[model samples]
Target: MALGGGTFTTMNKILPGTYINFVSAPRASAALSDRGIAAMPAEFDWGPEGAVFAVESGEFEKRSLELFGYPYTHEKLKGLRDLFRNIRKGYFYRLNTGGEPAKNDFATALHPGTRGNSLRIVIEAAEASTEETPVYDVSTWMDDTRIDLQTVKTAAQLHDNAFVRFQAEATLAATAGANLTGGTDGTAGDAAYQTFLDQIEPYTFHALGCLSDKPAVKALFTAFTKRMRDESGVKFQTVLHRYGQADYEGVISVENGLTGAADDTSAVWWTTGAQAGCAVNKSLTNRVYDGEFEIDTQYTQAQLEEGIQSGGFLLHRVGDETRVLTDINTFVSATEERSSDFGSNQTIRVLDQIGNDIAALFNTKYNGQVPNDAAGRVSLWNDIVRHHQQLQTLRAIQTFEPENVTVEAGDTKKAVVVTDRVTPVNAMEQLYMVCVVA
Candidate 1:
């Protein structure tokens, strides 16, 4: 009989062999995780059907044309460009659905949008020492220039290209150009956003930007955010335009969206990214608006104060520049004791960071790896203490004590219980003091 070969689940066959288990000591890292990812919906010229995708700031321009059939600087991409002006990277979902792809006599555009209408297919004779093979040079052109080219001798050699796919299976015939037509942009509805929310539920992002001013759409987002945070324990914030009554810790309602030039509330595009880009230990209060669009800052002093009182995200002129006055969430409640602390977005960030970090620590390090014994529980408590200690070291929390953390056996042998307390730190936002008379 081999030594240490028997299993130890239900009964131990000690007579035949012996079994033992070893676990590594829990280690908590002090490095804070990066947290600038954001999510939003938009009308794109092209993309995958009904899904969310990521686009980094460095690749947005190139990827936009490659995937969506339009360059980042195109007029149709202004809103998306504005979003990326301050955001370095993020996940984007297209809300508009069900559109027809533009088709030409030679091929069809990859996605449905007006941008595809500019595409044209050109066929020319292949350049070779001998033209006896009768090979053709196929070129995919957008406007006057060709984007993709291929050489094929037979119709069967003609494969699908990135810009357009081949349609004809007959004999190869040279043509001057065939312009694509009938490309149209799909319409956006409330259901489209709902689908986007559902598709993005599993994704982790710091903030969500809602560009619509529809009350019903805003309400749907508010409800979805509350449910995800409260029920599922997913932590993230959402920014919407002119949704002051949202009154939730996870929701930010922008009082003004567009700059004074237009009535559109496009400010949500930038605010969402900026809010997400803020570090966990920092705050966006008094942060300046450095994007292209001039945000609407036409509010009077009284109006600005009222907007803050109502938990609205307000931008005001600080001398010649416009800056965020106070970063706040819509959580105005006089009765509920815990509701008051949730007003500041910084406070929410701290709490959310703590929650997300601890959950990650537990799930990754402690879950199923450690046994359900008293020693294992104590080890978990120790890990928790170390995690909190690191948080304190980073100044994200204060007054953390190892003795405050406790872990014990749960109602069942397979479960464990944990209890702890922490005092999260918040940024300074206001100054009200009396100066002695000189």
Candidate 2:
């Protein structure tokens, strides 16, 4: 007889020690997660162009130089500065996804742009303490300050860094500095913006900003936003400047705002960050534009009314300050019964949260583990009830009757059907007061 029992492929054979797979509870999805991730494309000095670059809050200034090789206040970084200003207050992170690098004689800039021309490389010899060969200090300098330093005896030993790549067949010799020249920015076209979209498709952000005023570019963004929200199951809104379409609930078109000296579309920067930073349970109506751009509110009352009627995201002057009149997106329904329900961004937030949370719960925990029987269906229903109850507690929705939520087995034993409804709560945007004197 064999020392150990072996598995048999015979007729009624069974051999098993243990078969177990661990599963995590769906509690992680219940937490109120981070908010305000805004994505956009811009001209940058360094970093990978046509790829997503994540800049977390408070890291923009330092990371900009480290990655883009330029400061926020650089003359060529005006647009980036505008974006960082609004993002500083609201968004937790911003994703930059455009800009090509400029190549020079000695080394190429980390990113594509004329800013690369400002970079200079300095090679010096680091003194040796002992009786050994001296290590050369190869430093990458943007202007005066050294950003990266590598110690190498020969040019062949130099490795590529975030700032620049070492030139091949280069001799290691002490030189004052070799300034990079002929670096140029890539022409920004809709194709460049499309590259950004493609790179950011897998990312999750609250709002996407479209800086370009081109009709074709705006159309592409609108189509992308709609497809992502409706078909791809990704829920997020987009902010565009002066877009006239009000048929989609996922797009917020900025009608009028202050045009800074640098660019007229500077408002796109702040608006995108602010809309993205708005909490899921709150509305942005009447919120103050605390950004750096001076809004252009030189509009008549008639224009204001027309702008609102035409589904424009308008800002207006109020008591020596500019405030958002309505935090509405372009989502006016065609039917009278629908009314202006979808027009309010707050409503959309609630609905989006519900859809996202429920889908996450199903996909993460109950996808294929639970049986498709009565008990399993009840478990799913219980989870759904708990989730909606939590949303109700958050004041995101109201009028939730437990009886309205029902989960039943579908025609197929492997499927289950869920039917539930809840009234989404919106912030009080209007009031009717009657004054009476005794």
Candidate 3:
């Protein structure tokens, strides 16, 4: 038998034949995470309740009917269309799911919502049916269009589709059509919004949208944002309508409203998507609004300047196109710890990326796995320096010095402290030119 031929901590083995230890060569553990993810609580007529669902940009148009209980072109999906225009993926929570489902003799709606009232079931005898085997052709319709068709001999054989669930006990009968009724949409109260916030806490999204114009509801979202950012270390900014009074870096206050729309806070949808989809090196300043809504951009120059000074994210008309005035958040009052640079959304994005990426690196590569020694600290410092270098290469940040990063032991043996400095770059929103001619 081989004697004591493994890794050693104290080298006090009695009869060791051969001791060997293998380890992977040290490599940089820095990698940038993808963006373009957003979250929102929407008052839709149909969807899953009490949970967050993911919607991808590429699949929204194709699976809209099944996912949202409406076709892609339906007016109900206008807000979602605007949001998906820029974002790659969205985490959506239905706020009006505490309602009653529509039902008929044959089937019941899968989800509780007013949209389910449009469902109709049609049953007819199949051509191949006989007196012995009475096969029925069952068709599910949403309004005039047939959505699903199945051939079954009895109601028990009829399977549930995306729209509704069949009543297995009901007898299958040949009927022209039976319309579903009694569906209702519940009111989205503060409790429903609070539930949405709690459910969405575990999700990692770059931006969040609050479409409520009520001050109390906006305050709720603002408080949630601050808590997630400061305490939980989850960095994300929330878009709100006319909430500049929040005066927090994590809240983006939209000053411009939309015309010809029932929802005055609809602009928040597009802004949230844009913020989440924007690259780390880019800014939304002067970016044209290509959404479906008609923005009210009739603010004068002085009013626009004042709005910017008050930490409002505004949209203005530029040569017959609606454009973002400036990409800023509601952070007018800044302290020494967080200077005026924190107000810029681009700056916030850089800081957030650094925080998230470094946290991920530590949790995955170094935390609890590496030895708490000088070599481990040096490894972490090297990874951090490489991350900063990559950011500088992407032009997201500038003037990053490797010497500025340091990792040291914390108060406890298991704890560590890291200090890093970075300068985030912003887009050129203003230009000054002076010329003299003789």
Q: After superposition on all CA atoms, what RMSD does each candidate show versus the true structure?
A: 3.5, 4.8, 2.6
**Candidate 2, residue 58: lDDT:** 76
Two-way TM-score contest, 2 vs 3, winner: 3
By lDDT, the candidates rank as 3, 1, 2
lDDT of 2 by residue, 50-75 (tens): 45667776776766677556666666
lDDT of 1: 0.80
lDDT of the structure predicted as candidate 3: 0.91
lDDT of 3 at 201: 96
The digit string of per-residue lDDT tens for model 1 on 292-353 reads 67677888999988898988998888998989899898988746568577898887888787
On TM-score, the candidate that comes out on top is 3
Q: Count the backbone clashes (under 3 Å) in each candidate.
A: 0, 5, 0
Candidate 3 stretches with Cα past 4 Å from truth are 1-27, 260-263
Candidate 1: RMSD over Cα atoms? 3.5
Note the Cα lDDT for every prediction shown: 0.80, 0.74, 0.91
List pairs with backbone clashes in candidate 1. Answer: none
lDDT (0-100) at residue 340 of candidate 1? 76
Minimal lDDT window, size 10, model 1: 24-33
